[model samples]
Target: MLELTTEQVAALAEIDAKRFVEGVRADLCKDDPKLVDDTTFSSRLWRAFKAAREVGIERDENLVAFLRVEAYAPSFYEQPAIRAWLTRPGRSADQRFHDYLRVVRWHIEHPKFQGGLNNGGSGSAGNRGGSASTWSGLGARWRGFIGRGSGGGSG
Candidate 1:
């Protein structure tokens, strides 16, 4: 579960689940250029889960189950790991939920995840005043991260 300040809890209570979901969806669609290219539903879910956690909503198995069943509906053909995970019956729901959040948090917290913008700048900072070659390096790196072209690959 995420530790929250009083302010965070108050902010969380102000937004109902529906509003939270819409906000997350809008942010992902508008801000994340790589949304369409993402291979798994986890990417989007991670953002929503993170948003909820940031606002002080306590993450639990029920929330995870709701995300999986309603928001994600992940396909085994596209995301086999989730399928394998859901099929496994041994782990408790709480354990699975925690593990899921841990993995998602690790991914999102990476500097390179969700394009270089997650790390710093507008991603255009390197373009403004930096050398052409330097900007290109950043562009190439971001392109690769977002799986843009032939040279681009999954992270």
Candidate 2:
């Protein structure tokens, strides 16, 4: 039998977290070259990682999804509706994440939910035009990612 001290455990956890962040950063940069040029990109990704951990979203795939949302809507967690969903009782973090995905999908699918989040009217950190199409693309990518079976983790 082997035993580890608390400090050792914490050190190991830190190392794991750093590796995970680096891996995610590489993947995201590969997905979007623009991030490689953004000076604040690493900081934002670290913040996203912390936010996901705060909300108990430890799974890698879920963390990636959360980061994707953060990339689109910097203030996503601050949105009243999103905050409510996150704090909803009787649900695990994974369940809440999945429900959030559903809401995003529904919003993307419906025409009425189009302009609000994209134009700075709703609780999103609005971007330029073509947000609807961008969100639709994100939804499609998410669908494809999620449909690929449940083998995701820190890799």
Candidate 3:
């Protein structure tokens, strides 16, 4: 259920791929400067994250489908092609691109990020629902639109 906060999405929009990945790593790191380092894994993941963010995937609620690539990606968050793909100006609007933003949205907010793999990679998944300003949050807002608990009742 984890979702992207609007602030997170806005911040991501400004960074280049390298910086975007660094931000994801840092988010996984939970403010621990010691963990940031140069490595292929970090670089590739950054590329994937940057690509996804570009397309509006930065804030989706679905987790498993987002990561599946089912063809959305040629590889995981680490592939040279994905790097090129993300930066290609004409490639920005593809539907698959959103998968990156969506997964990272779930990734950083994972309870593990509250601790642990903020040490290595992101931590194990947890079931915390979406934050305000995202798809899952949008659903919640919709319920309110229909008055979920207000007894105003929805059609």
Find the candidate with the highest TM-score and give its number.
Answer: 2
Per-residue CA lDDT of model 1 for 94-128, tens digit only, reads: 45646654554444334344454455644342332
Off by over 4 Å in 1: 1-61, 64-78, 112-155
Better of 1 and 2 by lDDT: 2
The Cα error of candidate 2 at residue 136, in Å, is 9.1
RMSD to the true structure for each prediction, in A, is 13.5, 10.6, 19.0
Instruction: For candidate 3, write residues 52-152 as lDDT tens digits.
Output: 65444544322223322311222343345445544556544344456444444554445355334447745544343533223333333333322342455
Cα lDDT tens digits for candidate 2, 12-117 = 9978987888787777677666667878767777787887787777778888788776554454565565667776789978789888787767655453445554
Clashing pairs in 2: none
Clashes of each: 0, 0, 5
TM-score of 2: 0.67
Give lDDT for model 1.
0.44
RMSD of 2: 10.6
Model 3: how far residue 110 lies from native, Å: 18
- A best-first ranking of the candidates according to their lDDT comes to 2, 1, 3
